[model samples]
Every structure is written in C-alpha cells, then in structure tokens.
Target: MSDPMNVLAPEHRRLRIGDAWRDAASGATFAVEDPATGKTIAEVADADVVDGLAALDAASTAMAEWAATPPRKRSELLTATYRALTERSEEVARLITLEMGKPLAEARGEVAYGAEFFRWFAEEAVRVEGRYSIAPSGGYRILTVPKPVGPCVFVTPWNFPLAMGARKIAPALAAGCTTITKPAGQTPLTMLFLARIMEEVGVPPGVVNVVTTKRSGEVVSALLADGRTRKLSFTGSTEVGRVLLRQAADNVLRTSMELGGNAALIVCADADLDVALDGAMVAKMRNIGESCIAANRIYVEEPVREEFSARFAERMGALSMGHGLDDGVNVGALIDEASVTKIDELVADAVDRGARVLVGGERPDGPGHFYPPTVLVDVPDDARMLKAEIFGPVAPIISFTSDDEVMAKANDTEHGLAGYVFTRDLQRALRFAEGLDTGMLGINRGLISDPSAPFGGVKQSGIGKEGSHEGILEYLDLTYVAIDLPGPARCSGRPACAPAPPGRPTLPTPSRSRR
Candidate 1:
C-alpha cells in the first residue's frame, strides 16, 4: 500500500564513487522495478564507461596509502563497518526485499550473513601470515611475504547483492587493497547503502567505490583494460564468466569467478524419510530456488523414491506465496518475467519428455513475476532441466538405483557447484561425498554455507574459493625472498641493510584462467 522505497533516502540512490554521491557522467538513469508487483520503485543513476574508469582512477590513486596502512588499523576499520551495518540491518533488509523480492525475514538473515564477512575479514586482516622455511640448497633462507594484489574490480549479480559484494569487498579491504565494484543493474541499492556505511565507519575516500550501470559490458571492459586495475572478481552465469575471462585475456589480469551450477541432491534408501524430505526443501527452495547452488536435480533410491516424492510434492504445494514484505509468506516473487519464462520452459520441456507434474505446472495470471511451488516426478534423463540450472520454484525429482549409476548421472553435467546426500550409514555418506564431482557437499543435512568455511565451485562452476582464510588470498600476492646465508653478510652497517644476493630468479605462478 505504501512506497516500499521510502526506506532509502534520495541521496543513497546515486552512484558512490570517490568522495561524491552523484549521477552518472552521461546523465543516464534507469528505473528499477519491483518484481513483486512490476512497479517502478526507484530511478537510479546508470553509470557508463566514463564513470567506471573514473572509479578505477580513484582506486589507483588511493591504493598505495591504503595498502601501507597497518594491519591492525585496517582490522579496526572493517570491524567498525561491520557493527555499523548491523545497526541498520532493519533498513538494509527492507532494501533487499524491495529490490530483490526475497522475503523480509530472509532479507534480515542476508544482512546478518553479509555483515559477518566484514567481521570475519577483520579478524583475518591481522592474520595474513607469511611462511618461513629453510631453503633446500642450504645457501639461503626462504621466506614468503603476502601483499595486496592492488586495486580490484568486482561485478556482482542481483541475487544476494549485499552478501556477494561483502564477500568480495571485505577481503579486498582487509588485505589492504582498494576496490571499484559494480552491482547488478536490477538491485544496486543495497551496495550503495553499504558504501555509505563503510564511509561512515571511516573508509577513506576512493578506497571503495560502487557503480550501478546498465552498460556493464562497456563499463567493465574499460576497467579491465586499464593497466592499473589488477584483478577482476565476478559472480554470475557461466556464459558471462566466459565473456569476462576473454576480456581479461588481453591484459593478463587475474580473475576469480563463481559462475553457474547444476547441483544434485541424492537420498539413499537408508536415510530417514522425514530428514531426507526436510533437506530437500532447503536444497531445492532456498531463496525460492533462485540460488547458484540450489539443488537442480534430486535423485532418490528405488526403495524410498515413492515416499519421498509424495511428501516432497505435498510440502512444495503447501508453500505460501505473496509479496516479500507481507507476513507469513514462504515463497516470494521470481526476479523478473525472464526468470518466470525460463522456469516455465524448463518445466515444459521436462513434461514433454514424459515427466508428470504432481503439484503445479502452469503460470498464474497476475502482475508480479510469480511462479507456483511445483514438483514433477519421473523426470527423464534426456530433459534439458537435468543439464542446466533451474533457477526457480520447480523441483524435478528422478529415481535412482545404484551408487555407480547415480554418480554417473549426477556428474554428467558440465557444472559442479554443490551436491547433497542424506544417508544413515557413515560409509555410504562418505562414499557419496568423495564421489560427488562438486566443490562443496552436504552430508545428511541440506544447509552447507558458513562464513567460516571455504565456499566455491569446480569445473566451469568457478575459478577460486570465496570464504574463510582462502577468500583473503584472492586479493593477495605472495613474494618469496631469499636471504644469502653465506654470501651476503656483506653489510658494513652503512645503510642498516645487507647486500642483495648476486642473481634473482623470477617465479612463475600457475595461471587460473584457461587462456
């Protein structure tokens, strides 16, 4: 009934670059729509190549100073920002629900999850430990120092906008690196607000910047081409990831990509039927099934397939759907009409392949981009849904017989982001965990994401890890130094230093990019 966007002031609806919150240089603006009702909620500054390159310029100018700051001071600043974000969780949650259409309760949980990145990286800032080891040659002592990878550029997706930005920005700042980030065009408000919070918590001007733009390819290409911009971290589709990687090739820039996924959930015959059903709900329907790691294929053993599919279909049919801001709504709107269309096509394709819909299979006539919670049984292997990520509220359940057969079918896809298995026997659980061709696995439980653990994907799914200590490493470069044990005691105390070794060797790092 009310303007949900009243949660954000007019000042926060602009691009955050350097010390100014202003409109794009091109004077272009785009209206962001509310998916729940297809209403224009806000008109945001639409950045272009000029704004993006200007943001990069600011970061390059601030890089040396920010990287030279002491680790403890950086840690304190990040911690303060984390606290500041939590204080405004209610407002931030409202923005997320308004922009992305996730339930308000889930939006609050995202705020909590996102803020923890700042705190987690704050603790990690002071702990960027270097390594010391004796050289095998015995002529020199070897030590490696970790340093920031310099100014970085991040491209975030619309889903979980706050968390994705935080996951990238937190570690970059904690590692003493400056950054320029571009949020998804559809949902940039959270990141704009986050930039304000970081500024209030004492983030130096130009240390962090947010750019919202519809011309992402033009903007990102300019940033990547700039020699000063060192790394590019992106979270989106595998197709887009390949495009960005190709752009990265010309400059030889480092990249970290968390791309597409076709996750599978397997339930063994020995599993508790109730527990298996519950795990399926989480793995299938979290974020209304608009997740990169959301279970796309569900395989149940022959003995329990009937019972599990019946209960699952019943539960899926029972979910409540409405505007995310409404109370007691379990399922929220899809991102947009394109999302609804894609989900509908995937389901239709499966049904054409002889799959039977147990609950819902048709689109509703309404304003919002809403899809009913649907479950289909006997999903054929040749269906296109099995080969791709069905990023919606449709569940396609398939029956399996043996571990070998199931594993072959599960690993058949080109994407391998996450897998889940529920079994009472430890041996069977371990077998699935080991055999699954995925970066992360959930054993006997559905939930697997944790701020303290490493989160990433394998194959075309992603390039590097995103959480825990490994997350910080993405923003850092290691420099190995050798001290000449017998050759370089040649310090006459003239300049308070010893003479360097005769000749230095350049070390080659294994490239993560396929090119």
Candidate 2:
C-alpha cells in the first residue's frame, strides 16, 4: 500500500463560525500530496456545498458587526495577524514546502511577501475616503463615503499558495469585509496554517473562513448565487478567470482577477548580454517557470541572437533540477502530472513546426512531474508556445531585425500582462516602456510583483488592479457626497460656475472637489 497520510496537523479544524472554530457538517476529508515524492502530506476536510454555504452564512452574519468596527481596529487586527505570521514564518514556510514543493528559500520569500500585503493594507485601512462637492442648483447637501463591499469569495491557485491567499484575504479583511477563502485542493496546508494564525490574531471567527475541496465549481456556484458575497478575488489561468467572471456576473459581484501572462523578453542589440542572460535564466526557471510573469519568449536582435542563445543555453544546462527541498536544486517539478503532459505537447508541437530545441524540450523520465528547462529557436508566431501561455519552463526565442517588428510580435498575442526589454540605449528603453502593450514591464530586470507597485493586466489578462493603493480599493466602494454649504445658487452646468458675484467678496464656485 502507498504511504499513510503523514498529516501531523489536524485535518478538520473548526470552521470559523461567529467567534469560534467549528466542525464541518459534511465531515468529509481529502488528502494533500507532496508533488515531489508523490506522498500525502495532509488530509484536509473536503468542503462541500453545505460547508461553503455555512461559511458564507457565517460571514453574512458577521458582516455588519465587522463593518461597524473602526478602521483603526481593522488595521490593528491585520497588524496583529502580520506579527503572528512573521513570528511563525518558519513553521508556515515548512508547510508550504511540504504541500507545494516550492524551495525552502522561495517559500520563505512567499511568507514574507504575504505578510507585506497585510502590513501594507493595514496602513491603507484608514485611507479609504470620500470627496466633497457642491451640487449645482440643487440647494441640497449630500454626504458620500467609501464603505466595505461586504462578503467576498477568495479563490486562490495552487502556485504561490500563501502569497496568493494572503493577497486576497488581507485586503478584504483590511477593508472590513468578511471573507470565505478557497485554497487550491492540492495545496491547502499553508492556507490552513494561516487561518489558524488569523484566529490567534483576534480576527473574529467567521470573519475569515478557509475551505479546501475538490468540488470547487459547486462551492463557487453556491457562493456566487448567494447575494451576500458581494465581491470575488481570484488568481489563476485566464480560462478559469473567465469562468469566474461569468459566474460572478450572474450575481453582479465585483471582481479582482490576476490572470495568466505570456510575458516576452526583448533583448536589444546593445543590451548587457551577461545581465540579460542571468536575469532571463532566473525569470524562466524560477518556480520551474510556473509563474505568470516568467519570461516565456525571447526576442533578440539578429545581430546578437546567436551569441545570446549559446550563452543562455550554457547557463540553463548548468542549472540543477531536483526536489524542491534539495540543496542547490534550482528547478523543481511542475505542480502536477497533467501540467507535465501539457508542457510536452506544446514543446513537441513547436519542434514539429521546425523550431530548434536549443537546451531542453522534453520531460525527463521520472516519477515526479518534472520537465526539463526548454529553450527553442525559430519558433513560428503561429506556434502554440508563442501565442499561448505555456505555464512551464519553456522559452521560445525568435530573432528580429528591427525593434518595431519585435514590438509588434511581442504584442501580437492577446496577453498583455507583463513584458521585458533589455537595452543600453536610454531613448529606446523609454520608447519601449511607453509603447509595450502590457500593464507592467521590467527594464534590464526580471523582478515584477512588488508589494508597493500595482499588479494586474489589460486585454485578456483580466480587470481591475491589485497592489498599491489601487489594490486596496478593489475591496471598497467609492461614493461621492456633494455638500453644498448653506448658501445661494452656484454655477449651473456651465464651465465656469454661475458667474462669480460682482466684486462683492465673490468666492469661486468650488469648481474642483476637496477631500
């Protein structure tokens, strides 16, 4: 028989009800596995429709009370949660590694970045504001303010479990909205650990409930149907993001979606080849290239294509691929076996269409879902790898003679989430920065996803921004309240407010708004 479930942690913690954790009514359990070793790490409760409904009901019951609490209190609660998370960083990191197979170092980074969301949004809690204006000829005073968007459904993906989960949860809580989180079934341990931490941080139970289940569609449908879930936050593939958007639309719920990306790395003729190669290696190989912002395509100037490809291949070959927890293991297995198959099909199709496989292009014969780091040249624009979001460690490099041509090619795909350009020419770099059809760009660097910077995409990438002040506002509703000082008539829809009084200490008609 296979190894017994090694979940040392409890499988079913009390669902956060009112002020306490309570058992699920369904009493169903499912096992979470370590993808590296094909072993079960934990058996978590499988949240069915019943469990999901209960969570929603709990949040619904607690929404008014939580919303009434002062913003300072909300910020303080998130502050406590962040402190708890930092203090238990090691423990949570271990859980992430155990369940998701991300490296210990990267896992630690996820925890730190996850906590940053809490800290940043904690500070943003008080920034929610309303503007004051004078109504034109209404003679009435209006008061408008920003308020919590009520209950939200947070569905996070398997990759970057803790960070993605924290991205959704911290903001909703900071906005004084109760939430129900659904972590990917394959990796729920880290999220469960976080839920426990939130409880300890004095978050009122039922303020946040996490459920792990294979029946995600059913649970999601139930939450969407319930009028109480006013907003939905999701981070995953574009296809799934679309489905969620449609479902959310059925109930007219607000949404924040961080979807898939087909990011391109354009290496100019004068770029620092050494720096570009090093950064591309990390960008293409980090998280085994499972990241949405990872470099998927490389468009090098014809003058330097040969040298850059050769040097890039050498470095890629030097990478050590093994288990995530293994020391010096730079590349780890993909999240699942099916993803391995998909990567294989894409690479094979590209090769069949005359693309040259420079470094890697196949999955090694192994027990785990491991695909070799792949690099391709002469990749046709029609190749699936070029147009589709290959969520794996495959870089398809195509040569371009002109900057304009490559820019067109890079923006050819429907995805406009993230892109990269490496160049020593300041003028060219500025032009590319202004022209690249993407929401975020990296110049001479591969770093994206900064907590202080807003992250989201345009076109098919999804709607609304996440991160910075824009991210926090996703959980809030803005209302403009116009207050007309107890006075006479003002301008009536004219460019200049009703002609200012005739030199009798006449005041401007409050043309612009004041906070």
Candidate 3:
C-alpha cells in the first residue's frame, strides 16, 4: 500500500558518515513498512559492519574537533538544530504517525519532546562545572575538569523512534562527543528525517552520523567490539541489554542502557478517587500502552478496589481506537503483526489463568493491527501478563490491602524502571516515594520522562542514567591536574619526589594513562 502522505518526496538518502551520505555495503536494502497500513513505506539501507566501521571512523575524526570548539558555539549549533526541528515538526510528526501507528496528536507530541532534548542539552553544554581545591597548607592548588569522552555508538528502539534518538544524540553532541546512531528499522523515517533537518541546520557532517538497518545485533556487536568507540547508549529489551553489556565489557567501554520496564502504580487507600481514576486511564494507555515507562500493573487498596475498578473501567471504555490518521482516533495499532501477536498471547495467557477481563479484549476487527484498550482484573500474581512487561494497550489490575503488601508486590518484578504512587496522605506518599525500588517515581502523576530529570532503571530494567546532569557525566570524564609551584620537577631518569612541606601531603607520581 502507498503511504497516506507522500511527504518524503525526495529520493531515498543513504547512511550518514563522515560528512557524507553513502550506500550500504553490497547495496543491500531493507523495506520499512508503516504499521498502520502494513505497507512498504520506503526502503532504507541495511547498514552492515562496513558501514558501522566507516561511521565509527568518522565519529573518531570529528570528536576532537567538536570537543575543542567553544561550548557556546556548540550550544548555538544545537539551538539552531532545535529550531529547524521545531519548524518542521509537523512533517516529522506525520512521518512518525505513518511509521509507528501512534495517533497524530501523540506523534506530534513525540516530535516536540524530541526537539526538547536538543533545547535542554544545548543549555547543558555550557553548564559543565569542575571543582577547585586548596592544597593542605601552602603547596599548590588542585583543579578538576570535565572532558568529552570521544565518540559514542547509539542504538534506539522502534517504539519511540524520534524521542529515543534525540535522547541519545542530543546529549552526546552537547557533551562534545560525536556519535554514530542506528535507528530501528521498523520505524526509522522520523529519525532519518531528523538527520536531514540537522544537515540543513548546519550540524557539520561526521559529527552525527545515522544509519538504519534490520540487522540490529550484528551492527550493535560491531559497534561495541570496536575499541575506538568511547561510549555506547542502547534502549531496548532486557535480553538485548545483557548482550550489549557483555560485549562492552570485552572492550572495557562505557555503556548507558535504558532497557525494559514493567512499571507499577500503587493506588493507596487514601488516594483521591477522581484523580486516581482519571490518571489511571491515561497512564496505562499512553502510546497505546507501548511505552517502557507505561504503568503496566496497578495495585489498588482492597478497601477502595471496587470503586476504583468501576471508575477505571468506565474511563477506559470511553477511549476510542482506530487508525492513527483518523481525526477521531484516540489509540491506534500495535506497531505490526509481531506486537499484535505478543499482546494477544499475553492477554490469552491471563484469561486462561483465570484473570477477569474487565473491558475490551481481543484484537479490534480491522485491517490494521489495532487492539482495543483492555483491562484485566483479578489477575493472578504468576500470570505472564502480570509478571512480564506488557508493551500494549492492556492494563492488568491487582488488589492489595496493606502498604507493606503493595510495596512488596510492586517491587516483585525483576524490572524496576519506573513506579507511580497516588495518595492524598502526605506521609504515605512520602514513604512510597522513598521506598519504590524503581530508578524514578511519580508522586501523583505518571509524567516521569522530563528532559531535565535523570531517567534510567535499577535491577534488570537497565544500566546507568540517561538524562539531566548524570546523563552528561556518562559522556564525560573527570581529570585532576596539580601544578607544584614551590616543589621541584622530577628529573626524567631520577626517582621522583618532593617531600611535602610541614603539614602538606606529597603529590603522587604521574603515569600516562588513557581512559
């Protein structure tokens, strides 16, 4: 089927590497299909090891030059890039909607969120700070500074193509580290479009290269194994994250992974019923419930379980599901057949295990991969739908009585990326906020993916942080330099050392080491 909007009228572009666009090795191409229509929207290059090597080399050459450029200059470039993206956001949004099957409104919001990363990180470029210290007595002062960690290889998932790519690429560039990015083949158009926008906005070639490919594992392995890659940023399933971790370990390379999430929402007994019911409907169904941070499991207090369930069911039933391009559609399809199958399997497993179907179940009768917003009640603790991350428009609700019980149940999953707590009682809110084992928590709302906030997870959810000051640090290194004003320099062949003055400590010998 043809694309709904042939906005991408220009000829297909090749992968970006070293300030130039080049075709994939052997001229291999992969078909990119739009999930909403199950149609081949475009064919993108299937980047292989050869392409990966070229990208890495380009990034290596560009890193030092970019790092040495003034921070203000970097900020201005990023700002310009952000403006360009904003100007073309609607076009980008249509591309995302066409490829990912998210409603047009949600697609537009994702584009805006992606652009925000550029804006926020552009400011972060000038905010890096270092520490200054005084010597023990009257020796010399010590200074600490931050430096970019060279080139990084970034791989983002299909669920949130534009935002995820922005999350990694914006920070890497802002920190003065060049990047070679690989966007998921299933939904690469939005990001590819962004790369074009960057070029138009004057982001010099070689500094930020993007490649789209179907062979994720091979490309990722090639990137991680290369010694020149200073850092790796990945967002995907836990299984893939483990493999990347081991590969990065072999080279002793730095890695930041934002993997799977089976987030929990603890609805306390004293929570505001109206607010809880309203937020619950939106939190569990956002992105058609495909978000890694989407509230998958809801643990409601037994006392208010009945009322909560009723309100939740009413609100959920009101959600409209249809094609993303349709003006009245509220939720849309699971990316494709695979996702639809996965959601179906999980829902079936829950039903067979005795979970009550509170509302919409089974696939929506349509040509697309549309699934209705479903809510499962009386879910067994061991059900796959409850135990695993359900990346679909399904919410499985469970009941709990005590605070301790709910917290334990919430923390039971192997993954802990994000958690939500809704309570009017201040003490309970504070306690739950502090006690949730996830990397991030939302006290009353489910909004946790702020650009300024640190985003990541603990346990099997993922490694390292992805946003805010912590994120910049992941792409930077700290170095300490000490200059001795009164102490003599050690001879090239002589044993070193100046004994420190009265109460002063002596300086350690310098060894040339590269991080």
Each candidate structure's count of clashing pairs: 0, 4, 1
- Candidate 1 collision pairs: none
Q: Write the per-residue lDDT of candidate 1 for residues 1-515, one digit (tens) a residue.
A: 45556766888888888888989998999998888999988899999998998898899889999999999999999999899889988888988999999888889988999999999999999999998876776668899999999999999999898999999999999999999999999898889889988988899999999999999999999999889989999999999999999999888887999999999999999998888899989988888899998989999999999989999999999989999999999888999999999989999999999999999889998899999999999999899999978999898989999999999999998998999999999988888888889999998788888778899999999999988999999999999999777544345777546554568554577699846
**Candidate 3, TM-score vs. the true structure?**
0.92
Q: Which candidate number has the best TM-score?
A: 1
TM values, all candidates: 0.93, 0.90, 0.92
Regarding TM-score, does 1 or 2 come out ahead? Answer: 1
Candidate 3 stretches greater than 4 Å from native:
1-5, 9-12, 486-515
Rate residue 4 of model 1 by lDDT: 55
RMSD (CA, Å), candidate 3 to true, equals 8.1
Q: What overall lDDT, based on C-alpha atoms, would model 3 receive against the true structure? A: 0.84
The window of 10 residues in a row where model 3 has the poorest summed lDDT is 488-497
- Per-residue lDDT tens digits of candidate 3, residues 1-515? 23534655434356877777678886988887767777776887888888888899888888778999888988988899889888878878878888899998998888888899899999999998898876677477788989998889898888888999999888888889999889888887777777878887888778989887888888879988888888989999999888889999998888899999989998888888888876776678778899999998999999998888877887788888877878888898788887888888999998999998888886766577888888889999989977778898888889998988888888888999999999999998888878878998888886778888899999999889877878788889889988665554335553354444598676777778834
Candidate topping lDDT: 1
lDDT digits (tens) for residues 1-515 of candidate 2? 22222222453333544555555668777777888877766666777888898888889988999999899999998899889889878777767776777776778888899999899989988878776555666676667788899999999988898889888888888788999999898887777778877877788878988877889999998999888899999898899999999999988999998898999999999999988987788677767788889888889999999999989988887777777777887777778888889899999899899999998876788777788887888888788888777888788899999988988888887888998889999999999988888999999987777777899998888788877888888988877666656777555777575655677576557646764
